[model samples]
Target: MKSSFLKKHFTFVFFIVFLLFSFKASAQKVRPIKSDQGEVVTMHSDILKEDRRILIYAPKDSANSEKKYPVIYVLDADNHFAQMVEYSKYLSRQDVFVIPPLIVVGITNTDRNRDLTPSHSNVDYFGKSDTTANSPYKNSGGNEHFFQFIQKELMPYVSSNYKTQPYRIFAGHSFGALTTINCLINYPDMFDAYIAVSPSFWWDQKFLLKLADKKLKAGSTLSKTLFFSDGNEDSSSPGSPFHTDVLKFDSLLKKRNIKGLDFEYMTYPAESHMTVPIKSYYDGLRFIYHQWQLPPVSDEKLNPEIVMKHYKGLSQKFGYLILPDEAYFNDLAQWLVKKPATLNNGIKLLEMNTVNYPSSSRAFTALGAAYVVKGEKQNAIASYKKASELNPTSNEIKSRLKELQK
Candidate 1:
């Protein structure tokens, strides 16, 4: 009987312990994988007389913490912010380094009609005036004030809070595109590049089209990059004025041959008014930075000086000191180390990275690997030591150092 009682007690105790362990395991927290996409921030705007929201998307690479990125101020943030962020992130990847990682500041709208429209007009897009009490055009023609908001309030706020370069891009769509073109003509110096996707040139009876004709003079010097596009708005008729107006604007810019004005116009016949922005934004970025990318070349022709020269020209154009990305240099170094002739150049490029990015453990690791390839044991050990010091938790660095030490 006592054995029977003891067996029952032991079973109950084991069951309780198992239940406790299960409960404890269930209660334990799991660490979540965090995304470095971006964050939304708010600021009060005295120029607009309202609070504004700005979405900022930055590069995820923590190694380039000290790097200052070019800023893109995009209008109609509510509709296009996510798309821009994704595009910037993907296009600036190390594998597809067509464009540098950009800081995209998406400006959310409070009053779309008022802020985006350049002139107050009772007349709508169809050339019909709305005299009703609830007319949407009642609060239009605030583009100047909107520009002031961006210049005085928004720009200062972004510059103060973020690591931004002097180079800036202005991007907008439809009505927002109209504002961008207006800014381009009136305030050319505000941005280095301008992107207008399906601009509503038909607004206020084509006031902006006439303004463009007046502002852009023949043989005039307007040293800026401009990319504008139009989509198929009226599929029923190819001769519709919706697309014709854009053609007129394009012709006006082209015929004048405005000195220093770099511009490209694209037409997406398959896309509609709302869908054109996706392709146009992508093409616009590619067009503006067409010269920024380094073309692929044979390993024999690869030279660090050539890389430096390319970036120097880019720096001159951007009006800022630009350096080749750490990843780009590192990749070039790795490629160079594979060949006997380019081994020294590879080491040199890696050394340059150590100077440019002193805090990067991966840079030092890559340099160490290059030194190992060159049969320089002591140099490799030193580089690995520096890398290990920077990243103490890295088992790969630890193993590399151990293997080299042996």
Candidate 2:
């Protein structure tokens, strides 16, 4: 009777699988790719007295997870927001894990000149003073108020609505770059790092340069990261104030040698003002997290302690409590257990994930699989039971537990 029932059940299961495959093979649909776009948000700002539009790109992994991400504020969102979002996504990929997942906030401009300049001036780039009634620089020198808008409205909104780390980065180009440097000098505590691409240092006859010397006192402690670069801008020949001004700023930074001021300066002679941001932003991000990559470890030496210690070092450097992602540890452990030499070490790695994320059903499920590899059926049963309790709807966990019990 048992043999007859088994034969019939196998036939029925095979017939059902065949029918499903045949249906899928006969019917097909052209599918569009899922959009990988971020959210567009608008908030009314009392400081600016306008409805500010912004773009936000957060890591997908942040959803339904307790992970918090650092933020980078991008100026000229119309042009550079997508680029920074792509950089943040690609650099933090599992395969190319050089930096942590970042949340990018692209701040759109209401008045470009008024918000991005430090001083009121009718002068334009190339040292030409446009004193006409319609000068673009007429609405300039509201940078201090711009900073207030960010601090009072934008930053608070992001913090209240999203999971964010304490570290923040400010980035810009041209006039926006000038604004970034001005923020560094005046509102130093607003952001931890700053990126400036081809800043109009010649604005107001080198006003920011003079201010940098005065505000950034010699040997003072301004423990911040700054990456500034300039493009050709016809700077190859003599009397190119655009390139010369940046060189002078670099000289001043080197001369002052402000304590704890980590900075880098690069000049891209081949690139024009319009094209330098491509390479400049990429290199700037790499420079910011220069030591973020984990050192290579042989399987024999790889252990949970080493992984934990690596993240701890990063936490100290970034002034936040950084922990290894649960998925990363689970993958590493599974790979380790594939080889007999590292089987026990792999189990240890899985155990560490449980300690770090006790409430995670996935972590517990992974640990159970590692125990199964070691032929510890009782331990595996216990792990699956805990996982099932944490996630009662998981049929896979229930089936695994039943199989082990039987």
Candidate 3:
């Protein structure tokens, strides 16, 4: 009886193992997703007299269209490039849609002190003069040359090579922040926007503060957006000036009464210098594009014309032709078409997309699906046919067309 019982138990265990093996064999496998984003381009700078390594990150979906996008030129590419790229990606996503798509050009530094400082000085951050032979600030004060390189060589190269809009942003941190603010003061027309995170205003005994006083005249017109912020650098006496200097700069701007200068100053007490950038950058972008998101539309008055007008106003505000994302338009149209009252409005929105994105198979597919719901059989068939022709390899589009034809 014991031997019989043991054989039955072994049989049951083997059956369970067989079933597990069968399930494992039948299941589909998935590989890990590898993300290799951005492109590295080497460009020679005549003014700087060195080959500059430029890290360029365009919207991943931008390859399909000839649309131009705003550009952000970030100083300290090695430290901040990828972070900017990711931020741009998330903000410009179809769902989030806070900012328009951007082309981020990250300019790396060959000489940190030389390129980022505004004036040649042996004075360190702590208001102490170091005239030693091996001082860290020996090669300082090349901000003018750096700006020349950016304005003359770098900007032109990016503009010519990439589909870029007229609006541009200059972003930096620490001495890089000082450089950006200096550029804004001296070269106001250089960029449409400026972002200075924890600018090293203590450089050269607060030379930038003095310069700002001189350059930013009474009621001068800046006509630009500037977002600058600082962390709790005053946690110790050694770094207190960083906090105070930014405060002074903010006060100067308020006193100057600069016209058309949309700016914001933020303070992050919990963050240290090293960690402040992440929060500062995120908030800076939000501040720069504070009024970017579309206002809520009532379901009763939901119409494509309102959407169109909103984007036109955005284009005017941003100084560029801003269009709604194609995917978002499709999703919005589908949502709008749920009620009979807004069906034609939804159709009109999709039509606007077809006009904006003439070559997108997905756009046509979406339009066709909308037409099908509207019971416009002929229109749906024609839209499906166009989509299939655009994407000949798409069996799904072909199937839709075939069903519509039948």
Candidate 4:
């Protein structure tokens, strides 16, 4: 009895120790929630001089010594931080190849109006300036000071603390939109891309608009990309000003002879000021990085017989119900015919994609192409026929089979 009691006591002691360690671990400081892919992480930055919060998102692979990432600074981070974080991570995935992975710096706000507007003026949404003592304009017109914080404090802190490249993007909306455009005009070299989503052109009786007119050098080579947009809420009340100010700015940009200044303006009539960011942000990112795509395949690489098989597998992977686009099929065909040595490994890669996406007919088509190059013409014909059956309307596959028959 004595021995049994001692044994039970030892077991109880072990349980107590485990509980203590688990409790200690649970009590550790909280951090930002990790992104879905586990490659993205966010953390709060204590670099703002004002009573504001900031968040930074970096790719997990950013830790590699040789890898460098472009930085994107977003305004009103409290609202759009998560969406932008996921977009950056997924669009830059190894399989996507749309754009390079990027570091995202999201700056939250304390005094949004004071930091975003250009000049100090107490004017209501109407053209009449407000002269009242208690007007909200009392705390307005602090954008220049805020820009200094970004230049002197935030940028330096981020560059020091993270692995970053020289390329940078500045993004904002509404009042924040005005802030980005103002930065582009006043401090031209701060960022490579300036994204202004629905800027408040009515601020200070259009003080910034007038500043833009005087500021933007028409003949100079600014060498930057700028994208801005607006939603459908065209309310022109005294409090809710609505005059197509974005349109005016768009026209001005069009008339400018500024060399190397790439710009785009979008109007989402279906989306509102609140909802446009979701769509516009994705489109804007794609647009800015459009030139970063992989090189296209040449005619020598495009073997129709080999490409047809690959298309079958891809269709199965994407879902047997859907088929590969003409461009995608054409590129793969070119690669298979032009580079037979690459076919062996590339075929295996397509097989993995097919396994992951079992319904993709494109994967099967690719597999057939590899077999054909290996002197398995019959297998190639089978693959081409399967691709044609899966996607009956595919003219490329049909033509390929007819040539082989002849």
Q: Candidates' lDDT values, in order?
A: 0.91, 0.89, 0.88, 0.72
- Tens digit per residue, CA lDDT, model 4, 284-312: 89878775543465444434344445556
Query: Which whole-number lDDT from 0 to 100 does residue 372 have in model 4?
Result: 66
Name the regions of candidate 2 deviating beyond 4 angstroms. Answer: 1-32, 62-64, 235-238
Ranking by lDDT: 1, 2, 3, 4
TM-score of each: 0.86, 0.89, 0.88, 0.64
> Lowest summed lDDT over 10 consecutive residues: which window, candidate 3?
59-68
Model 3: which residue pairs collide?
none
* TM-score: model 2 vs. ground truth: 0.89
* Candidate 3 residue lDDT tens string, 43-118: 9999999999999987756426677788999999999999999999889888898887789999998999999999
- lDDT, candidate 1, 185-295, per-residue tens: 999999999999999998998999999999899999999999999989878555559899999999999999999999999999999999999999999999989988876
Q: Give the C-alpha miss distance for residue 348 in model 2, angstroms.
A: 1.8
Worst 10 residues of 4 by lDDT: 318-327
Give per-residue CA lDDT, model 2, range 73-120, as digits (tens). 999998999999999989988778788889999999889899989999
* Winner by TM-score: 2
Cα RMSDs of all predictions?
Answer: 6.9, 11.1, 4.6, 14.7
Number of backbone collisions per candidate: 0, 0, 0, 31
